[model samples]
Target: MTTSSSYPDIDAQADLMVYLVLSQLLMRHLTGRWLTVQHVVESTHLWLLTNGGSVDWLQRISLGSRAQELAEEVAQIEGITFDVRTLEAAFSGYQHLNHRSPAVAAIYGACVAFVVERRTAGSRTGSEK
Candidate 1:
Protein backbone atom coordinates (compact mmCIF):
# COMPACT_ATOMS: atom_id res chain seq x y z
CA MET A 1 0.00 0.00 0.00
CA THR A 2 0.99 3.61 -0.51
CA THR A 3 2.68 5.50 2.27
CA SER A 4 0.93 8.64 3.51
CA SER A 5 1.83 11.50 5.82
CA SER A 6 0.00 9.74 8.63
CA TYR A 7 1.21 6.13 8.16
CA PRO A 8 4.20 4.77 6.31
CA ASP A 9 2.29 1.75 5.09
CA ILE A 10 -0.63 -0.56 5.71
CA ASP A 11 1.50 -2.62 8.13
CA ALA A 12 2.17 0.44 10.26
CA GLN A 13 -1.51 1.23 10.31
CA ALA A 14 -2.27 -2.34 11.28
CA ASP A 15 0.33 -2.18 14.02
CA LEU A 16 -1.23 0.99 15.41
CA MET A 17 -4.65 -0.61 15.37
CA VAL A 18 -3.35 -3.65 17.20
CA TYR A 19 -1.75 -1.39 19.79
CA LEU A 20 -5.04 0.39 20.20
CA VAL A 21 -6.86 -2.89 20.63
CA LEU A 22 -4.48 -4.00 23.34
CA SER A 23 -4.66 -0.61 25.01
CA GLN A 24 -8.45 -0.68 25.01
CA LEU A 25 -8.48 -4.17 26.43
CA LEU A 26 -6.12 -3.16 29.19
CA MET A 27 -8.19 -0.07 29.96
CA ARG A 28 -11.34 -2.14 30.31
CA HIS A 29 -9.62 -4.68 32.49
CA LEU A 30 -8.35 -1.91 34.71
CA THR A 31 -11.84 -0.41 35.03
CA GLY A 32 -11.48 2.46 32.59
CA ARG A 33 -8.46 4.14 34.05
CA TRP A 34 -6.35 6.30 31.76
CA LEU A 35 -3.31 4.48 30.38
CA THR A 36 -0.15 5.50 28.65
CA VAL A 37 1.46 3.23 26.02
CA GLN A 38 4.12 2.21 28.50
CA HIS A 39 1.47 1.14 30.98
CA VAL A 40 -0.26 -0.97 28.38
CA VAL A 41 3.00 -2.57 27.27
CA GLU A 42 4.14 -3.35 30.78
CA SER A 43 0.78 -4.71 31.81
CA THR A 44 0.67 -6.89 28.75
CA HIS A 45 4.14 -8.19 29.56
CA LEU A 46 3.04 -9.18 33.06
CA TRP A 47 -0.15 -10.70 31.76
CA LEU A 48 1.73 -12.79 29.21
CA LEU A 49 4.14 -14.00 31.84
CA THR A 50 1.26 -15.04 34.06
CA ASN A 51 -0.69 -16.64 31.24
CA GLY A 52 1.78 -18.97 29.54
CA GLY A 53 3.01 -16.40 26.96
CA SER A 54 0.42 -17.48 24.48
CA VAL A 55 -0.91 -14.78 22.21
CA ASP A 56 -3.61 -17.18 20.99
CA TRP A 57 -4.88 -17.66 24.51
CA LEU A 58 -4.99 -13.91 25.02
CA GLN A 59 -6.87 -13.58 21.75
CA ARG A 60 -9.39 -16.19 22.87
CA ILE A 61 -10.08 -14.65 26.24
CA SER A 62 -10.06 -11.00 25.21
CA LEU A 63 -11.96 -10.90 21.91
CA GLY A 64 -8.71 -10.04 20.16
CA SER A 65 -9.76 -11.76 16.97
CA ARG A 66 -12.94 -9.74 16.87
CA ALA A 67 -10.99 -6.59 17.41
CA GLN A 68 -8.73 -7.48 14.50
CA GLU A 69 -11.78 -8.05 12.36
CA LEU A 70 -13.07 -4.65 13.33
CA ALA A 71 -9.71 -3.11 12.51
CA GLU A 72 -9.79 -4.73 9.11
CA GLU A 73 -13.22 -3.24 8.52
CA VAL A 74 -11.99 0.16 9.53
CA ALA A 75 -9.07 -0.14 7.13
CA GLN A 76 -11.42 -1.09 4.33
CA ILE A 77 -13.60 1.89 5.09
CA GLU A 78 -10.49 4.01 4.74
CA GLY A 79 -9.86 2.39 1.32
CA ILE A 80 -6.81 0.43 2.37
CA THR A 81 -6.45 -3.30 1.91
CA PHE A 82 -6.01 -4.88 5.29
CA ASP A 83 -4.36 -8.15 6.14
CA VAL A 84 -5.37 -9.88 9.36
CA ARG A 85 -1.94 -11.45 9.61
CA THR A 86 -0.33 -8.03 9.95
CA LEU A 87 -2.29 -7.34 13.10
CA GLU A 88 -1.60 -10.81 14.42
CA ALA A 89 2.12 -10.47 13.83
CA ALA A 90 2.19 -7.02 15.42
CA PHE A 91 0.38 -8.23 18.52
CA SER A 92 2.73 -11.17 18.84
CA GLY A 93 5.81 -9.02 18.29
CA TYR A 94 4.69 -6.48 20.87
CA GLN A 95 4.38 -9.24 23.41
CA HIS A 96 7.69 -10.71 22.33
CA LEU A 97 9.52 -7.47 23.12
CA ASN A 98 9.14 -8.28 26.79
CA HIS A 99 11.29 -11.32 26.26
CA ARG A 100 14.16 -9.24 24.87
CA SER A 101 14.73 -7.10 27.96
CA PRO A 102 14.55 -7.45 31.70
CA ALA A 103 13.62 -3.80 32.02
CA VAL A 104 9.98 -4.10 31.02
CA ALA A 105 9.07 -0.57 29.98
CA ALA A 106 12.42 0.33 28.50
CA ILE A 107 12.30 -2.15 25.66
CA TYR A 108 8.88 -1.02 24.50
CA GLY A 109 9.82 2.61 24.71
CA ALA A 110 12.95 1.97 22.68
CA CYS A 111 11.05 -0.02 20.10
CA VAL A 112 8.56 2.79 19.64
CA ALA A 113 11.34 5.30 19.33
CA PHE A 114 13.12 3.18 16.74
CA VAL A 115 10.01 2.77 14.65
CA VAL A 116 9.27 6.47 14.78
CA GLU A 117 12.81 7.31 13.75
CA ARG A 118 12.70 4.92 10.83
CA ARG A 119 9.38 6.24 9.64
CA THR A 120 10.53 9.82 9.93
CA ALA A 121 13.66 9.04 7.93
CA GLY A 122 11.64 7.24 5.30
CA SER A 123 9.23 10.13 4.91
CA ARG A 124 12.05 12.62 4.52
CA THR A 125 13.69 10.46 1.87
CA GLY A 126 10.41 10.03 0.02
CA SER A 127 9.67 13.72 0.05
CA GLU A 128 13.10 14.56 -1.32
CA LYS A 129 12.65 12.25 -4.30
Candidate 2:
Protein backbone atom coordinates (compact mmCIF):
# COMPACT_ATOMS: atom_id res chain seq x y z
CA MET A 1 0.00 0.00 0.00
CA THR A 2 1.17 3.49 -0.86
CA THR A 3 1.22 6.19 1.78
CA SER A 4 0.52 9.91 1.18
CA SER A 5 4.00 10.72 2.46
CA SER A 6 5.47 8.75 -0.42
CA TYR A 7 4.37 11.40 -2.89
CA PRO A 8 7.38 13.22 -4.28
CA ASP A 9 5.62 16.57 -4.68
CA ILE A 10 3.74 16.52 -1.40
CA ASP A 11 5.31 19.69 -0.17
CA ALA A 12 4.43 21.52 -3.34
CA GLN A 13 0.87 20.27 -3.16
CA ALA A 14 0.56 21.39 0.44
CA ASP A 15 1.92 24.80 -0.40
CA LEU A 16 -0.58 25.14 -3.21
CA MET A 17 -3.37 24.25 -0.83
CA VAL A 18 -2.22 26.95 1.54
CA TYR A 19 -2.11 29.41 -1.33
CA LEU A 20 -5.69 28.58 -2.22
CA VAL A 21 -6.82 29.23 1.32
CA LEU A 22 -4.94 32.50 1.39
CA SER A 23 -6.50 33.53 -1.88
CA GLN A 24 -9.97 32.94 -0.48
CA LEU A 25 -9.21 34.92 2.64
CA LEU A 26 -7.81 37.75 0.58
CA MET A 27 -10.86 37.89 -1.60
CA ARG A 28 -13.09 38.17 1.43
CA HIS A 29 -10.93 40.85 2.95
CA LEU A 30 -10.81 42.88 -0.25
CA THR A 31 -14.49 43.70 0.08
CA GLY A 32 -13.87 45.57 3.31
CA ARG A 33 -12.18 48.92 3.87
CA TRP A 34 -10.07 47.77 6.80
CA LEU A 35 -7.78 45.43 4.90
CA THR A 36 -4.48 47.19 4.53
CA VAL A 37 -1.42 45.94 2.68
CA GLN A 38 0.39 45.57 5.98
CA HIS A 39 -2.42 43.46 7.33
CA VAL A 40 -2.32 41.24 4.29
CA VAL A 41 1.41 40.70 4.58
CA GLU A 42 1.34 40.02 8.29
CA SER A 43 -1.61 37.69 7.99
CA THR A 44 0.05 35.81 5.16
CA HIS A 45 3.27 35.37 7.14
CA LEU A 46 1.35 34.13 10.14
CA TRP A 47 -0.67 31.71 8.03
CA LEU A 48 2.45 30.28 6.46
CA LEU A 49 4.16 29.79 9.79
CA THR A 50 1.13 28.11 11.34
CA ASN A 51 0.76 25.83 8.34
CA GLY A 52 4.27 24.44 8.69
CA GLY A 53 5.60 26.56 5.85
CA SER A 54 7.69 29.66 5.52
CA VAL A 55 8.06 32.70 3.33
CA ASP A 56 11.25 31.20 1.89
CA TRP A 57 9.36 28.14 0.72
CA LEU A 58 6.63 30.30 -0.79
CA GLN A 59 9.18 32.46 -2.59
CA ARG A 60 11.02 29.45 -3.92
CA ILE A 61 7.98 27.83 -5.47
CA SER A 62 6.59 29.00 -8.81
CA LEU A 63 2.81 29.08 -8.92
CA GLY A 64 2.11 31.80 -11.47
CA SER A 65 -0.09 29.84 -13.84
CA ARG A 66 -1.87 28.03 -11.08
CA ALA A 67 -2.42 31.30 -9.27
CA GLN A 68 -3.93 32.85 -12.36
CA GLU A 69 -6.33 29.95 -12.66
CA LEU A 70 -7.25 30.23 -9.01
CA ALA A 71 -7.84 33.97 -9.39
CA GLU A 72 -10.15 33.36 -12.27
CA GLU A 73 -12.06 30.83 -10.26
CA VAL A 74 -12.39 33.19 -7.33
CA ALA A 75 -13.40 36.07 -9.57
CA GLN A 76 -16.10 33.97 -11.14
CA ILE A 77 -17.40 32.85 -7.80
CA GLU A 78 -17.45 36.42 -6.57
CA GLY A 79 -19.03 37.78 -9.73
CA ILE A 80 -16.11 40.06 -10.36
CA THR A 81 -14.05 40.65 -13.45
CA PHE A 82 -10.35 40.15 -12.87
CA ASP A 83 -7.56 40.42 -15.40
CA VAL A 84 -5.66 37.23 -15.12
CA ARG A 85 -2.65 38.78 -16.81
CA THR A 86 -2.56 41.51 -14.20
CA LEU A 87 -2.55 38.88 -11.48
CA GLU A 88 0.14 36.99 -13.35
CA ALA A 89 2.19 40.14 -13.51
CA ALA A 90 1.71 40.73 -9.79
CA PHE A 91 3.09 37.29 -9.00
CA SER A 92 5.90 37.84 -11.47
CA GLY A 93 6.71 41.14 -9.85
CA TYR A 94 6.65 39.57 -6.40
CA GLN A 95 9.14 36.96 -7.54
CA HIS A 96 11.53 39.62 -8.77
CA LEU A 97 11.23 41.86 -5.71
CA ASN A 98 14.14 39.86 -4.15
CA HIS A 99 12.86 39.70 -0.57
CA ARG A 100 12.39 43.44 -0.36
CA SER A 101 8.78 42.85 0.72
CA PRO A 102 6.34 40.08 1.41
CA ALA A 103 4.60 38.42 -1.54
CA VAL A 104 1.12 39.45 -0.35
CA ALA A 105 2.13 43.09 -0.06
CA ALA A 106 3.76 43.12 -3.46
CA ILE A 107 0.74 41.55 -5.09
CA TYR A 108 -1.65 43.84 -3.21
CA GLY A 109 0.32 46.90 -4.26
CA ALA A 110 0.25 45.82 -7.87
CA CYS A 111 -3.48 45.23 -7.69
CA VAL A 112 -4.14 48.61 -6.11
CA ALA A 113 -1.98 50.28 -8.73
CA PHE A 114 -3.92 48.54 -11.45
CA VAL A 115 -7.25 49.61 -10.00
CA VAL A 116 -6.14 53.21 -9.63
CA GLU A 117 -4.80 53.29 -13.14
CA ARG A 118 -8.03 51.89 -14.49
CA ARG A 119 -10.04 54.48 -12.62
CA THR A 120 -7.82 57.24 -13.92
CA ALA A 121 -8.12 56.01 -17.46
CA GLY A 122 -11.85 55.70 -17.14
CA SER A 123 -12.16 59.25 -15.92
CA ARG A 124 -10.01 60.48 -18.79
CA THR A 125 -12.30 58.67 -21.22
CA GLY A 126 -15.37 60.17 -19.55
CA SER A 127 -16.58 56.68 -18.78
CA GLU A 128 -17.61 57.71 -15.28
CA LYS A 129 -20.20 60.43 -15.16
Best by TM-score: 2
C-alpha-based local distance difference test score of model 1: 0.40
The TM-scores, one per candidate, come to: 0.26, 0.29
Runs in model 1 deviating more than 4 A are 1-7, 37-129
What's the CA RMSD for each of the models? 14.3, 17.6
Q: Residue 109 error for model 2, in Å? A: 24
* Pairs in clash, predicted candidate 1: none
Q: Native-vs-model 2 lDDT?
A: 0.40
Number of clashing pairs per prediction, in order: 0, 0
Candidate 1: clashing residue pairs, number: 0
Identify the runs in model 2 with alpha carbons over 4 angstroms from their true place. 1-34, 54-73, 77-129
Q: TM-score of the candidate numbered 1?
A: 0.26
Model 2 lDDT at residue 21: 29
